[model samples]
Target chain A: MTNGKSDLKRLSRGDTENSGGAIWHENFRQAINILRSHKMRSGLLIVGVAIGVTTVLAIVTVMSGLDKRVQQDILSVNKPYLIVSRFDPFAGTKDKRDLMRRKKLTSSDAEAIEDRCPTVDRVDLQVNAEGMMSVLRYGNERTNLIQVMGASHNFGYMFSFSIEKGRFFTKFEQDHKARVIVLGYGPAKDLFPHRGPIGKMIKIGTHRYKVVGTMGSRENIMGSISDNYAIIPYTIYEKDRSSKRDDYQIAITIRDGFTLEKGIEETTALLRKRRGVKPGEENNFYITTSETFKEMLGNITKYIGLVLVVISSIGLMVGGIGVMNIMLISVTERTREVGIRMAVGAKKKDILQQFLIEAVVLTGIGGIMGIILGMFAARGVAMLIHFPYSVPIIWIIIAFVFSSSIGLIFGLYPANKAAGMDPIVALRAE
Target chain B: MLITVKGLKKIYDVGSQRIEAVAGVDLEIGKNEYVSIMGPSGSGKSTLMNILGCLDTPTEGKYYLNGSEVSNLDDDRLAYIRNREIGFVFQTFNLLPRANSLQNVELPLVYAGVSAGKRKRIAMEVLDLVGLVDRAMHRPSELSGGQRQRVAIARALVNNPSIILADEPTGNLDSKTGEELMAVFNKIHESGNTIIMVTHEENVARHSMRILRLRDGKIESDKIIN
Candidate 1:
């Protein structure tokens, strides 16, 4: 029996006048209740989502931080755009050897370019010797495999080194070929602890060089050049017993408004003039731009990041499939509930939204927990490696959004099937 | 007329063959009426109740509820009518096992978009009416068959629908408990809410003012006893 008067009133006040928010909240609350009813199933579903988000977040954060460190290390060495060297490879092989024998870069070559080439702003000449070595000892413990570099006085300005304990070598020391050396922060602390390293005498192989200053901890770029080396004067390295005329590498900075191409052209012309290289002869030495160096490092990191993402994606995919399977089970288990809601004026859209939101909330909460755990894991890793712990905020946001969207996308078919159930059949189901 | 059906039919296609559940039926019921359609197994009384409750639309002919053509209505419209006009109780006392009596009573109002505060208040009032107010927080499994049936009745009354459709509402209870359920139904009818019940027991059908007996998919007799 139906009463028209009350039926119309109920229709107007009940379903028609309710806002979408009210419907959504009611459906969401019911879904939460259903989840509470099946605690084990809900927990399993959440763990799936947590695994997915954690893998993604961890991989992304580690890769992004490593990428930043690599870039910073490259920038500190040289301006990425300029390449200044003596070698010209475009002129052919026979001429390259001839040019190499005659036109090897030296300290004078760097000076001539700085004077003649308007594009050359600063010049740094580095001389490295295989015979150059350092001995680090702390109370009978010593390391013999320490590399030592001979650098100009402007080494700190050119390479962005922060003096942690003492001062850098002065211009007078470079000109006079002083035997004083500066120790990087790591080597200094390792060799001498609980005492200041400045004004200390450290033996480098057979020679005794005075420690003048100490460098700060430099960012490690994929373990390439860490703050564990020793810096000495370029002139002093040249005059040492193991030094030779051929063991030199020169780096130069370009002036403002000068392109790398111009710097390369001017430096090549100047070297050719100084070394008497014929027009048809090729240059001997290799010169690389900072941009090219960075490109090489970036390619390595890109390949590494790609591999990590692919590996992490495999984990996430398995987790996503698990989530989908669980949602399917949830739909089948709640068939009668779906039918009852459908019979009681819930639109198919309403049912769909309710289940989908439930899935998303489940995964979203899991994702948030995973992110928190992953951040701690990353921090633990960074601490183990003695690197700074950085939170990857961008990856965190992406993980959250991606996990919820995965829930929505994967939960759709099951939710629709549940919403389409026939009430009579469902209610009559034993 | 609160409900009118003319030549109502229901056909089910199970695999290759067609089975007629309700062949042809003509019936009218007025507001506040307490009526029971009684039949043996496979006699089609349940099919008639399904049509009357808007859980199933008639396969052919017209069925009107409160002067609205409901037989040809789509699924969404049928759902609206079911939620707004018909409240249902089943033989098994089909309350959601996970839900307490209060939440079970609030289910229909939730779909109707009633505010939570008002929904709870109305659900409590209906539970009080069914004498299950003290057992409101107890789930269906915690209650006896008689108490569970009372909880289902309270759920059916919470929406204040135009009619209550009970399909053997006391079918699972003892005779004493069944009598008590019928007494509750009698009190509900006296309160001016229409009720349509389907029962196989003649004694249960006798509680209603009117009875329609069905056999072989058609009404065998219709009688008004009160």
Candidate 2:
């Protein structure tokens, strides 16, 4: 019996007082109240569901954050851009020797694309080779071995960057093949520290190039790559290389009204013409866009995501079974109560609704706990792997709906069993 | 007549055995009549009480209550009839263990879709009638045997049904507590509420105005008692 205040006045006059709420509302209140009272039982009951929802949500959130990072940060420097490499930068089946033997491109090819293709916008040439890594130094402070890349002045502006300090070299400095440089994030941090590195000179190989600016950091998907390189003027690169044509790669931008497809087709046709390829032969080059990289990443992770979802679903199924088992035990345990209720005039549907609501409330609470834990899990992993932390709100809603539906789907049998009881037999149960 | 039964029979199938718990019996009572059914163990008194309470349907027979054919109704309609016309009290005090006395009393109104305010007020009325309004908040586990039965009585009275069917209502109570319970029943009866109780105790039966005795699933005797 509840300890409601014994209002002396209302005791004698049954007054047909205004009782409130629908039958289900009462059921819901009672269910929630009881669950709240017995925390440990409900918590244990919902653990399976919580684990399932956590697995799916954490994995999906981390994966989505990585995917977004790949699209906006790593793959596409500026959205709707293309990269023309001599061979596939990401494909795995390529013969390395054959790729090396393919007709190498030069800075002239990048110039030709900029000059001839109507859809081709500004182009930046990258002329780095496999052994271009070198340790940089200034005032006795040094950096780890980092890639040395050479590109046009606008290269820093277009690729994974914003100028953190000062500015990139101008066209005049690039034309003069001046020894000015824009240090990468790692080099700038190591060589400059508190004292700004802008305008200070740093040694790269044998040359001392004045630091014009520093590039902002970019976090690649795999922690392997980083903004740890030094960018020099392309002309200065040519002046230092033994051969000015070191199989260059061109980064191309599409005109405002044109698509990357248009830019790729135009550049391919123009390059094939310049290289004297016959109409039928494949152009001795590969083109990549944001979409291509996304597809490439998708192909690999698609399997992983599928496996995680299947495992999570299995967890949910197990959780649902646990719920059904508990519900069955509850029905058996409350058989006498069920009989008493029937004697007091509760219908079969009323019993069914009571048990069904109980199941839903259980799973629904588990789902909420899972969502909170999953978000925390996602944050932990995102920070662990250096990915931006984000949770897809839609997936949260889906997880909740999915968990409660597990209740609806699996709770049916036990609820039916409870509702189908013969009041006499039930009342007779000990 | 407020109640009537003709040739009512109930046969239960237990695997390979056919047990006729109630075999071909008939009886009747009018509104506001307080009746006691007396019988030894296995006398079909319990079975007949189940039929009258609408907790179970007879295997064969016609039953009329308040001028309507009760035996022919469907499960849902029977539930409605039970809600509106019949209340039941059991030997074990069958109060929902988790619910308080107030909640137990309000349960019938909840099923009847009465709002919370009216339910509380009406349940309080019944609790006061049983002189346990101050114990409204006590759960079954917290109450003594007498107090628990009093809560059960309040629950039976909450809906103000036409008749209260009690099967050995004090079977689990001490004689002193049982006598106290009979006093409550006498008070309800004096207020013109009809009650039919099944008990093997002759002293308990003495509280009722009329007594019907049963044996071997048949009425052995019917008599009016002081």
Candidate 3:
């Protein structure tokens, strides 16, 4: 196209010296006319590109939103905390079976970490089961959606849980196996709307426990049912619901001036010693910091997002090829017109630019429509999943440029074929 | 001299056959001359016209247009000379079907890099010159055969080219409409622009000041028409 411009400048002088505005304007206008004349073909082409762009934009937005939500809910509050568990949080079925074969972590392991690791400040042991929905009843208010967690006395401090109206259970209460509980904010609000939840008796599975505390709302956490849960001391849980072989997950917080890495390292060593893990074998447990957990979450989401992008790009490629195919047909159909253009003074570059611009415009329109549709789709999914809505400016730019580049790359062959036509033969075409 | 041709030959290789379309023709045409080349089908007049119009280059000779050798010029440079020096009217009245008459007329000037304002003014004036001012916005598909040819002629004249070349310009029109188009060409010629036309009909050749008759790829006669 640049060669054509310079040639025009050199030749368009003397007695015929008047034709000089950026010639692209005329070519662009002509291209638009051609596309408009073939409405159905152009419409299908636009829709193809739009679907490709929409897929990319929607997936990037939703996945990035989920990533941010995970950071806020898990990593943000637990940056200085580490978890020691019987199974990996990110385990596949094979890894799960391997970890299941190993002995479960117990309260002894938790106490051993605290006693031996210099960086450890305190440890909390929590025993919980899934797929077991327990209901809590207080007078006329009942919540069948309750989650039951049995933990040691320091669970609240380690996990950033604060008491709103009362005190947390003490070591004396835990040791005595007292029938006491702390209600999360959701259950507290639902059961005791106008009055304090402390000192109230709640029923759970033919047992009654006095509410020792009501928890403050957990700010910025997402997708956790903790708000509807109640906590009971591990001593009382061991006496009532848990058996001797029941496993416990431990949360450990580092002391001031210590990093979670140092805390995890020292604690892992201590557990290896306590559990008599052999020198040549893997540890019989999993230990992970919030940072590691966040990375695992990010990697999974990124992998899924990358696969989706690859799939969507194929759609874009098909759309781009479709544009090229239609443009080739157009060139063949208008062979006589091209000959006339050549006879009248259009340079080879002019013809090339004309067709290239047509393809780009076709896909550019699709990209714009796709962006709009993508935003709406992402927003819809975000709303459905309770994920926050965010504008992904970088992804939008990438989608636009990628779609336009697709047009350029694919449009080259047909445009070149048109430009290289023999004018004499073209004029003779019917 | 507006055009000078020396030892012009055009050979076509169709499969194994080497066919000489125009063999060893020599011709000279001075400025403001109204000349016609007459020949029967396959007698090489069309090949000669293609060479003179800059649509095709000669295989074995030199063509000089306005003192510059053009037979060996490349495609782009040939396109430039075609834009600036020669105006072409086809037998089919080859105006772009999608463009209106005014746009068709503006084409040559557009290739010459004429600005929009001047291109429009000149295109309008050329349309007026061809007596089709009222049909400026009518596309070729919308115009009668006479009007379409007039539009093609107007296009040929738009850049005020050195010579107007019409190839059987009246071939597609009825005799009456053809007469009307010849009158339009007579007006264009009287305006002092050199004109070269290719035709086989004697009546069409009679409209020119001089005639060259081609027989079997060679000039049979060059005559002054009184």
lDDT of 2 at B26: 87
lDDT string, candidate 2, B6-94, tens digits: 99999989999998888889899988789999988888999999888877788899899998888878888888778767878889999
Lowest summed lDDT across 10 adjacent residues in model 1 chain A is found at: A1-10
- The segments of candidate 1 whose C-alpha lies over 4 angstroms from its true place after superposition are A1-16, A72-83, A86-109, A112-122, A127-150, A162-168, A176-303
**Highest TM-score among the candidates is held by which one?**
2
Candidate 2, A1-430: lDDT as tens digits: 1321133223322543323355787789867876886687778988878988898889888877777776666564764568888888656765877777777777788888988999977888888867657888998899889888788866865765878899988989988999998887788888888798988988977888899999777656645357788889888987875353365778888889998888888988998888888999987788887677777777666677767777778888889999998888878888998888888888899889888998999999889988999999999999987888899889899999999998887888998998999988998899
Please identify model 2 stretches exceeding 4 Å from their true place: A1-21, A46-56, A86-104, A130-146, A162-169, A176-221, A235-246, A257-286, A294-306, A309-329, A383-385, A406-413, B72-74, B142-144, B190-192, B224-226
lDDT of 1: 0.78
Which prediction has more favorable lDDT, 1 or 3? 3
> lDDT per residue, candidate 1, A271-307, as tens digits?
7777776789865556667777777778887789889
lDDT tens digits, residue span A339-402, model 3: 9888877778878888898888888888998999999999999888778888589999988888
C-alpha RMSD of each candidate structure in angstroms? 5.2, 5.3, 6.0
lDDT of 1 by residue, B82-157 (tens): 8788888888877778889998888777777777777787778778778888999999999999999999888777
Alpha carbon deviation, residue A73, candidate 3 (Å): 5.4
Which CAPRI tier for candidate 1? Answer: acceptable
> Candidate 1's interface RMSD, please?
5.2
lDDT of prediction 2: 0.83
